[model samples]
Target: MPEVQRIVFAGTPDFAARPLQQLLDAGVRPVAVYTQPDRPAGRGRQASASPVKQTAVAAGLPVFQPPHFRDQTSLDELQALQPDLMIVVAYGLLLPTAVLTTPRLGCINVHASLLPRWRGAAPIQRALEAGDTESGVTLMQMDAGLDTGPMIAERRLPLPATMTGGELHDALAELGAQLLLETLPDIEQKLAAARPQPDTGVTYAHKLSKQEGQLDWQQSAQALANRVRAFNPWPVCWFEWQGKPVRVWSAQADSAEATRPGTVRRSDERLYIATGDGWLELLQVQPAGKKAMPVADWLRGSGQALQSGEVLT
Candidate 1:
């Protein structure tokens, strides 16, 4: 009989892939992996591989891409595996109470944020959007409520003011993987205890909305920069240039004095837009479905000239 833990891992995205890979590298081959079914993607609407699915496949492990967890037959299959414990990381599906209790050691979760703080879908982005000073991964015991579980471990990370959502996502992913690796021995020994989430403060990191990417120049420059960082690599921050939409990849709050919010202020070969608080300098941008280019390159190709007093909205 194999002495390694009989584990079932559940997750779907890149954030989940890190821990899955770590477990495999540590020679803790999961008994099975359950991820979200592949979904139609791209212009052709082809079924695309999920990050977790790809990692599971690369590791030569059994992969289950189920659409739902409610079917008793599917539940029975998981139970038959007799998993010692289930490790779930952003699996996207809610594990029914029955399945949660089925595992011999119950389930452990690797949440991206310190629990009871930023608990929900988009913790990393939410932290950047809120201008949070720090964020971390919380290892928790699964419960019925959304991330309303007792924490087994936690590791904090300081938030950088200039970091984009994508960067923070990568950072948390690595941190989460390490935290999970650290918590495993205790989990096997049944020495881990579930501590209730604090009741004093609770905030939900709601899922990202596509509309949030639509840049509103009326907002403050700092606020707009936050939006640019928060929505990156998803619903990218964008606004119209000569009636054409351009996505802004990177930018900084312009340190100059402001006149009217949204007015274009060109400073030292850079494009700046006045906002309620200050000005913002456009660093990287894509012109209406074209490749994202540095702000300087976009300047050379434009027909209409960017000038002060022209509102960017």
Candidate 2:
């Protein structure tokens, strides 16, 4: 194994921050940290530092926030660091070939999904949406292609039937952190032994959009239920109800007979929506301008007079 000195880290978001924090906690601090530039966030739309930048700042590490490494000046600045190795996790920027080879040992990325699968943005959500029974983290040697890197190390985690995207994200973040820590001790050896990902079974996890969160009643009830789990804590799944959008936070698939695709029924204090195959039981939902609550609570309160056989578009 080669002696790893002067490490550089590049990442953004909470998922990336966790591994950076773990590195610091383990006394393997990076010489410099690179993150995306501050951007407008939240309802205020005020400039806010990314989670990795915030963590770097708190640790008194040198922080660089370049919009993208498209300029010669940015590339020169990174080259000046003379990093022995660079660790990237959810950095949200495509690194050019120059940056990839700048480091002595090259750059490595901590991706959320197993390589040749979910090889783009929104992997966690995509995995849940597809109803995969298992998910894992992959540490790969970075290449020019998008997440098309050779695998250095990987760790798998079983997915329960009720796992949500948010839940899986948190789990995989910590798992990735642990995997990175373990790989660092023998990084050179692992890199030397890294294997190319198989071309078969490849699937891209396309970036998510708010429009995709709209529930399609024509889909199977189980599929709709999976979507509800996949999209939670994000552009949550929703349906139009009386000219307003009702967000479905949590739901379950049932074998109840289907009526019209979008028809809704109330029974035994539970709310059910008919789908192509069966029914989807709405466990939690949020009205257009209200907080999310259980189906029973919503039924007793604002949804008291919700008529059975009412259709949700």
Question: Candidate 1 at 127: error in angstroms?
Answer: 0.4
- With a 3 Å backbone cut-off (N, CA, C), the pairs that clash in candidate 2 are none
TM-score of 2: 0.98
**lDDT of model number 1:** 0.86
What tens digits encode model 2's per-residue C-alpha lDDT throughout 46-161?
Answer: 99999999999999999999988899999999999999999999999999999999999999999999888999999999999999999999999999998998999999999998
Q: How much is the lDDT of residue 312 in candidate 2?
A: 78
Candidate 2: where are CA atoms >4 Å away?
Answer: none
What is candidate 1's lDDT per residue for 258-288, written digit by digit as tens? 8887888664457888888888888999988
Global fold similarity of model 1 (TM-score)? 0.94
Residue 112 C-alpha lDDT in model 1: 88
Off by over 4 Å in 1: 1-4, 188-192
lDDT of each: 0.86, 0.94
- Total backbone clashes of model 1? 1
